[model samples]
Target: MKKIILTLFTAIAVLALAACSSTSGASKDKEITLGATAGPYTDMVNKAIKPSLEKKGYKVKVVEFSDYIQPNLALSKGDLDANLFQHKVYMENFAKEKNLKLSEVVVVPTAPMGLYSNKFKSIEEIKEGSTLAIPNDPVNLARTLIMLKDAGLITIKEDTNQLTASEKDIKDNPKNLNFKPLEAAQLPRAVQSADVAAVPGNFALAAKMDLLDALQLENMPDTYRNRVVVNTKDLESAFAKDIKEVVESKEFEEVIDKEFKGFGKPEWMKK
Candidate 1:
């Protein structure tokens, strides 16, 4: 029993030392790995952010993930130096839920959710009892609800926790809009059938729908805008600072205009 306990303690100590050593070696290198959800964001890092960093003497490698959770998990585990697929709300919530220390490096241009209709040509044309398709997931459902409220079609309850708000939190539906919650990817298709579909910005872009064509685009709050995220312990690191600087650069915004049109700029970028 004593020998088994001693051996387990020794193994644990060695693993801890290896983790620290790996982190120490990683922080000293000029090479950086940035994680993103596959598609536009991966392309954004490759086409826009990567070249700028390369010119400044850093080797920037981007890793693409198919899902939302892995990028942050990889970031927390130090497999990535930084990541760029999440909004501040997601980062804060994920960090709290997982008991991880993560912080935003900077907010970037985000595609805003848009209210679209195939039959009704305009917001004014939306009729009573028109069915609206919304994301079923809690956070995105909240976004859709908020956007609907902003469009003057609905009223969310006062003092409501809007981040997790659902159809039940709606105090009034002036248009008598019936919400059909669906997987986010299905929303673009919903516009063809449903009277109105509130599509989040990322999915709309994936479907190649023109954001400006929507009857209304979400006036996204700062918290909702996607941002660069890094581990909290690395907040003061040189590479982290460089990531913020690159996002703030004029070149980055120029790319946003040329390659990623219709994604709204963050407030910091607006200034």
Candidate 2:
């Protein structure tokens, strides 16, 4: 009887140990995984958001992608808990096309697209028949065209909007300027090949392009602010809550102002 009791106690101890190990593994798996583009957005996450979130007892892991497409693809496929890479307009268009159920958690920052040129110091300096490079992607191509229109460099048809604009949309080209649409990632480098290039803020910074005084930026409205996004199904998850707190925190805002200057400030910060 003594031998049997001893054996039973040993079995119970082993089971308890296994249970504790399983629980610990489960807890570690609860850490939130976030994705962002590989520039100022990733920098902001590391410098401001991650430390604040750690203080709040949440594990935050940031994954960086080289270009725009992979982050959303990962989030939709359940590989990431959230992404901080795109504006609402872009997200809406992506969601509709891909049939993904992702939702924006909060507006983080706005990297207003700027038209930069090594050949010209100002818009007035751009000559007739000047060749310009724009982003080839549909959404960004439209955005670049709009910026050009805003700068009075070109004119689009009156009915055109952000959702739809093509080379065909150009109504007036006084200079008969050449429109060369390239990928967003390629725009900065293409500046050397063209008279002017419309480049996104993050990529411009990555290329060490001095856009502050070198180019003209489009006037972005409050509606175009970029955001942190997550799967709609997981909107109420702990990970989403943690990401929201990190993005909307004062620390994050301070870092944006200090590191990025005024180039990437969200409308909320302007208030």
Candidate 3:
């Protein structure tokens, strides 16, 4: 009799454990956490994405990081369900270097990188040999050089891409421009001293710099569009699909227009 009682108790305990495990997994699936660097990314998620997800019966959490590294790391470590702050090229490079399984879930709008000035009012007004501050990092430096080329202040080699372009890649400098490379974070502050500073979109938005005041804005390529990134495994999941649909919806576009006036429409949306 005692043996029968023990067997029954063991069966009940096993069932209870399995039930608890199943419930935990189900709860996890119902909640989604997204990570992004503080600023535009956070603004988009909070002002737009969060409400969309919550309406679909998911509890959404937006985790804000102050720098580039932590968001990707957190997402990879399963601390975040997704992230929304990197270009595909940058994320691909980072994933390759870190051996992460990250992939782009959706392409968000291309925030046009712009040349902000404290001294010059227009690109033509920028005098010859004027020191222009650019992001020292390779990707942004290359992009800034391209924008300067388009502005006719300088010309980069046609063969150059953002990764390979440098001061030496300047095929011509009509303005006899003096280039100063500084940390991207410092470009906003540097504009006070430098004649013109090539600032990335997020940084400009964070600094509350007026986009209309920019001397020139880069025509963002499809490749430069910001993305919603996630674990490769999550790319096909229903939760991810819902999130993608929400961002690509008309409501989301309205938020984009209302929140980011000068930030141009995304190429994917052009379809």
What's each prediction's TM-score? 0.85, 0.78, 0.85
Each candidate: what lDDT? 0.89, 0.81, 0.86
lDDT of 3 by residue, 1-271 (tens): 9999999999999999999999888767789998888887798899878998888878888899998899999999999999988887889889999999888888887578899887878888988889988999888887888888888888777787665688889888887888888999898898899988999888888888887678999877767778899999999999889989999999999998888777866777888
Off by over 4 Å in 1: 1-28
lDDT of 2 at 144: 79
lDDT of 1 by residue, 205-268 (tens): 8898999999999888888988888999999998889888888899998999999888888898
Which has the greatest lDDT? Answer: 1
Relative to the true structure, candidate 3 reaches a TM of 0.85
| Model with the higher TM-score, candidate 2 or 3 | 3
Estimate, for each residue in 80-181, the C-alpha lDDT of model 2 and write its tens digit: 888887888779888999998888888876667898888898899999999998888887777778888889988999998766678889899888898887
State how far residue 65 of model 3 sits from its true place (Å): 1.2
Candidate RMSDs in Å, in order, are: 11.6, 5.3, 6.0
Model 2: lDDT equals: 0.81
Q: Which of the predicted structures, 1 or 2, would earn the higher TM-score when compared with the native?
A: 1
By TM-score, who's the top model here?
Answer: 3
Off by over 4 Å in 2: 1-30, 67-69, 96-98, 221-225
Clashes of each: 0, 0, 0
